[model samples]
Target chain A: MLYEKKEAWSVLLRLYHWAFALSIVCLVVTGLYVHEPWTSTQLEAVRTFPMAYMRYLHFLAGFVFTAALMVRLYLLIFGNRQEKFWNAAPITPSNIVNFFKTILFYLYIGKKDHRLGHNALAFTIYVVVFLLAVCQIITGFYLLYPESVFWQGWGLKLFGTQQQARFLHHIFMWCFMLFAMIHVYLVVWNENVAPEGMISSIFSGDKFVEKS
Target chain B: MSRNLHLSDLNPTLDRRSFLKACTMAAAALGLSSEMVPQIVEAAASPQRPPVVWLHFQECTGCTEALLRASHPDIGRLILDIISLDYHETVMAAAGRQAETCLHDTITKYDGKFVCVVEGAIPTKDGGIYCKIGGRTALSILKEVAPKAAAIIAIGTCATYGGIQAAAPNPTGAVGVNSIIHDKPIVNISGCPPNPINFLGTVLHFLTFKRLPETDSLGRPLFAYGRKIHDHCERRAHFDEGRFVEKFGDEGHKKGYCLYKVGCKGPETYANCPAVRFNDVGVWPVSVGHGCVGCTEPNFWDTMTPFYERLPSVAIPGDRGVVSSAESAGKTILGVAAAAIGVHAAVGIGRRLGKGSSCCAKPAASTQASDDKSKE
Candidate 1:
């Protein structure tokens, strides 16, 4: 019957969110174009730098994406209680139980589970997505500086060749795209049904919760 | 100094002037400057030619053919003047027992003082029975010769990686020289048939410096394999401009546009072919209108196949029969994910609407009961 407004995300956290999201969007778009250029200029080869420009954009966005991930990783360790990794993704027995409950809630078999931050299932997926981001960064750097002795010894040994690294990078790009789609849909769904202001919280850093 | 035998004396056709020019060209190709020419010339005429024993196995003799076509110094000058090629099956006048004798004599006479140049992949399956010479398996001969040599030179893709023979389902268990000889310093000059200048440069560097040139992790000389082919491509301007050849004989093809769209492997392949060219001619595969096949990379046959396509197919794990490009696989997975989400969302909305209609009166009754209790 009554609700109270509270800060769910810090200003810094919100900034990191949009930066990560926008950078990923730029990376994917430019990365796909670099992978397979779809446009060609009619101007002289010396007059245009279409492919070069695409590659430059992709690399620039990659650095931005990497920086955003670094910030999030720092926050995961040292941020507020709700933003701390263990608090959000704890694997305790009760957390495991609630993880399944969240699944059931998604399936419309149970009432919605209320939380101040990410639900158990969502947090687990975020952890996996973060791991993929790390992999993307490693492979991206390997592709960028293939002649580096460090990468030649370690990255080549891990992925076997530049082609394999490119493949993994491409695969991870799709994974991020998939995650973004599902994440947007779920946030919209929760905003409409759960009265948490889930969508607006990302922008305003506040959400309405039960008074208790 | 006693009148030492000069390089010109051994190869009369290569006069002193041409000999000096060849040396300079070689130094340039090896990423050395004019200052190294005198040292190279001295090494070339030193008369203490380092004996070389060339072995062939599971090969097409293309590397030797490429060597013969080197015109700067010529193969005759190379084998007779620069380095003493004691035993080469393709060029040696000896055969059968005589060839075997030459091989044995060189190994023993120049023991720990000669270079061993392996020209092909070694067959290790079934006791290396797939390839043999004089009834001796290539594996056994290599095991015997590699240990005695000062350094091993793996002089082709076959000897560096496994080449075409080591592609998927490698029936003969083909392996490179490095796979067998780990104790000795091995230099890999990798290519389908490596440029002869690279080989000559490596040998001359050894003769001049009394040691092998610096090599990449793959054992290829850094002078040749340090930068990607794409980095120094003649058609790089086209690549940057996004002007590409779409097909084999299109207008773009005739105009010499970038071959990136037609599956050029230069972007991923490391070599100096664009600069050095091949057969002493100013033309390589790309310069002549074909895309690079990435011949110098390890496992090129498997990793750089479908020569006219840009990217390798993504191998599906646990299912050898299914292979798909990365784009196709990504599109399929994204499609499935979209459909699943659509179904989930539709069912969720339908269930919520059904519950709202059926339970519309229950919440009103409970609110009224709570209000009455609060009044009491």
Candidate 2:
């Protein structure tokens, strides 16, 4: 009955994917370095080059992270949807059930179960990462408002002086570290349990399933 | 440059009878007791300007060099005019027996009346033989001079904490004048060849008030040593913004970013060099694209090191990529995470052993059992 069913990552989604990942990694590393004496301190352009350049790099990357967020939101709202259990998992109760089951499985509870759609564990990671990213964006904007007013201007006042904003930026960075460790563990665990859970979806936009 | 100190300058040197006669005349002139007039006139009309005996201990004589650079219209002349510079080893014209005689006479005559300005550190090891002036140990010389002085001013880092000589493995046990003279009230003006103005300020304050100015816990004058250099650094904006130069000539270096990343001890050091500046010049160390060496801090020689490296402290707020210390943020989040992990693990293990245990064990269990029937 199906006329045509093609599997592929749309350009906008891929743009969102890489940008989000890069931004998260950047935020985590910089945040950690600032807080603790991690590896002493790596020399940067600020060490050799003029100070303005390092600031530019940090500030400019902030906007890129914001743009990536915007695109992810767009994909959630406007991207084409296929009539498949996997892509449409968000709408199914099975998705919610699988999410918790995955959590229990990770904690080493019961027999492994097959899951389709956004699995239970995946949902939780998704939510936590999304929130932390939002925190980073808010804090980043607060620091950037002296230059960027669109979002950061009000954020600055809400956070108090630039020092308070700075203190928050350092504190909030740990979220990304926690998120990353958990993300890597769960993604690989998912890959092991359901070989094509994330890999197939991001690459081809479709996951293989046994027919009835 | 003049060497000789006159006995006539002090009318008190007049013979006992003449002094008593002068006292009677002065008392009548001033309406005071006859015997008290000479002493009163000496105290009121021309009190002896505090004699400043500049002593060079273990140092480069930088404090002496720096003092010569002072220019406040008439401050240098005022110093020369007011203080009887009986002896300054570096600049005084007297030498050999003449200089020795000068020091002896000043101590013998002025004794408790003159002020002593000791520059550089005093070595205490090896019977204090590491440094000597005129074949006498610096220690013995200092011990001899310190007791008689009314007040003592120890100028420059060399005298504050032995400068770099006391950095590590201090063979000589080089120490400040205070470390050697525990009884005298020592006023320290600490700096690596400290700003001339700080020294002048202390000296003027002493002259005007006839008493030492307020000092901090370390016996440093409060006016200059009260504030941190970082608090007033011109590049403070760069530090607050998390803008820093990583290397010797990177792009940020060209833009003159903060040197905090490059071992700026500004945070830990307390001094006003950044505010008052040096040499009347418009720039300081950090302003010149270098980090503060914290030259003013106590034992900055040993405590602050890797001169071009960041201090092992601080995650400044207001910086774009700043992250706070984990002690507050990391500890709280980590605690939650650890608790969450523990609870989750316990729930999973309990579920494996029992009927229900977890965030949603019972619901997941019923559903999984239902699914098993469907698969069959």
Q: iRMS values in order, in angstroms? A: 15.8, 13.4
Candidate 1 residue runs with Cα over 4 Å from true position: A1-51, A54-212, B1-12, B71-76, B312-376
Minimal lDDT window, size 10, model 2 chain A: A44-53
Taking the tens digit of each residue's C-alpha lDDT, what string does model 2 give over A1-212? 22222233443455566766786676555545444534444543222322333344454455556666655554444333321124434445766666666667778886555543455556556656666667777877666555556555666556766778778777666666777687778777767875544665665554544343
lDDT of 1: 0.79
lDDT of 2 by residue, B98-217 (tens): 999989888878888788988888899989999988899999999999899989988988787788778788888998887878887888889888876676666655664567778899
Q: lDDT (CA) for every model shown? A: 0.79, 0.64
lDDT tens string, model 1, B1-376?
A: 1122354346456567666766777799898989889999999878888899999998899898888745444533655577888999998899989899999999999999999999999999999999999999999999999999999999999999989999999999999999999999999999999998898888889989989989999999999898888878999766654467889999889989888778899888999999988877678999999999999999999988889997544211211111112223434544543454355345434544754644564453343323322322
What TM-score, to 2 decimals, does candidate 2 have?
Answer: 0.52
Ten-residue stretch with the least lDDT total in model 2 chain B: B318-327
Q: Residue B328's C-alpha lDDT in candidate 1?
A: 38
Candidate 1: residue A17 Cα off by (Å): 34
List where candidate 2 sits over 4 angstroms from the true fold: A1-212, B1-48, B70-78, B318-376
DockQ of each: 0.04, 0.03
* Model 1 DockQ vs. reference: 0.04
> Which CAPRI quality tier does the interface of model 2 achieve?
incorrect
